[model samples]
Target: MSTSFWILCHDLKGGGVIRKSGSIIKSIRQHTDAWINVHKLIPRDEERITEISNTRQRMDYYEKAISLREAEDVASLQEKLGRTLSKAEISRIGVSKLRLFLKELLRKRYMDSVPLIIPLLEKEYNNTTRKLNEINRELSTLDEVKLKEKGRAFHDLF
Candidate 1:
């Protein structure tokens, strides 16, 4: 049977006993194509997910350094002032000021490396965050593509 006849028969508004062999085959092909495209995306998604995980690990390491350095600064500040400080008080003064105060203390005590370490940690943390955001955006695009293909296949059935 001709494809045009099958299409015309399927398109009839009030047809009874209309055959849809061609339409069914087309729908099946769409579904198969959708499945294949989605499967092709799987390895790329896995690699991006792994990259995100590694980026998060890098972010966590930088965050840990920030926390440790901040905590040490807080303890030193508290000890120097001979008083405990509230979290609000510590935060209100800000990290840069706290680091500066600690730098002065370290300078007086002849210790070194606070200035170098803080900047490096901040830069690394920011870079990791940027990388993570880019990866997430790419994954979102991939998911959107898969969704579009799946929608096309599903809706073509009717």
Candidate 2:
């Protein structure tokens, strides 16, 4: 049971923020029972993650650079960043490039269907929370027994 932490940023209008987030974390924590923290970003960071602001402008600049085959400029930019972009990083950027693509492909009716995804997410969170509570209870019991044993050993020595 390997546990991996995820930083999920969900759109606010979808509703069930507490239930969905809590349940998913709860379910996973049950199996591997790892630590996970889920948080809602402020509007500014949300805009940055969703590429709704200056981040979008930076993305556009990079996309134009790639399309033009401006190798020297790209190299300079990469050097300034102190690291080369991995394929995964580039793929993520390409996905961001598809924001407009999704908007164009999905009509208002389809956009309205987005809330359907929340239930599955909520179930996952609930299960994880339950498991975490079970694990915590077991640990508490073990600690109590250990403390009692130590007390008896000290009394016997006296």
Candidate 3:
């Protein structure tokens, strides 16, 4: 079975699902302490993000995808997806949007608002780290099993 992975830069808010591209995932791996999630978007199919070129591109790809609304026509879609934008562009869009969202939510001025945000961020970081470690362990085990099976096969043949 063929497998694919996407490296994404997730935030305190929900993460953007990155479209797996060339070395983008590798770039992400080089920078950022981001945690990865293995998703089975389809039954019996799994995906992961291995590397990203840099933190900037990783952030940009994520922002563009998130900011992309439902394009009404092929022209609009092409315009949006056509040329690549710089890392700065991506970071600007993402940060601006997130700020706007937070501003709106904060406008409510609820009593528990500040307290709520802190715990949520902490929880997200904790969860992401835990998941990353778990995935590494699982992958290591799988590799060991494969190696053992290969050794057994060789012995049987001899």
Candidate 4:
């Protein structure tokens, strides 16, 4: 049977159904002849920012399809697919554990599509970190905040 027809027969209007469809989508390339590169389905751009935005949109769509919110193995899943895409509290967690969390998150989030999207995610992560550092640098240059922290003991150390 065609993948579309099979999906049509399955009632996928609800969140639960959508998740099931997602799991089926994951298993398709493995269990059957169906194989797809989500990257090819998406539009590409020359500019890195545009490319990142488009990739992120597609990622969001896939994320919705296989949302970990209702997974049967939910207990084993990490929070927010273990993605601290913007801000990772590195100081609060173990480095190896965080690495494991990221690895698992990527595995679950992208699965077979990781080859196409890993570079995008990596670039996006680097971009996010760069922008965050820029913001922090700008904040550090502010005289008011510096003055406010003058008397604090651990402010400089932390």
Q: CA RMSD for every model?
A: 31.1, 20.4, 21.7, 24.2
What is candidate 1's CA lDDT for residue 146?
A: 81
lDDT of 1 by residue, 31-126 (tens): 643111111112212211111121234544655887888888888889999999987778735353554466467776664666768899999999
Residue 54 displacement (Å), model 4: 47
**Deviation in Å, model 2, residue 15 alpha carbon:** 34
lDDT of 3 by residue, 90-135 (tens): 4435333465456556766765587888899999999999999999
Q: For residues 1-158, could you state the per-residue lDDT of candidate 4 as single tens digits? A: 22212121212232343245566445554665444332221122211111122123454564565554334234333454774322344322433245446656776877778788889999999999999999999988889766677847567677
Q: Rank candidates by TM-score, best first.
A: 1, 2, 4, 3
Top lDDT: which candidate number?
2
Model 4: worst 10 consecutive residues (lDDT sum): 42-51
TM-score of each: 0.26, 0.26, 0.23, 0.23
Candidate 1 minimal-lDDT segment of 10 residues: 35-44
Local accuracy by lDDT, each model: 0.53, 0.55, 0.52, 0.47
Model 1: runs farther than 4 Å from truth? 1-54, 93-158
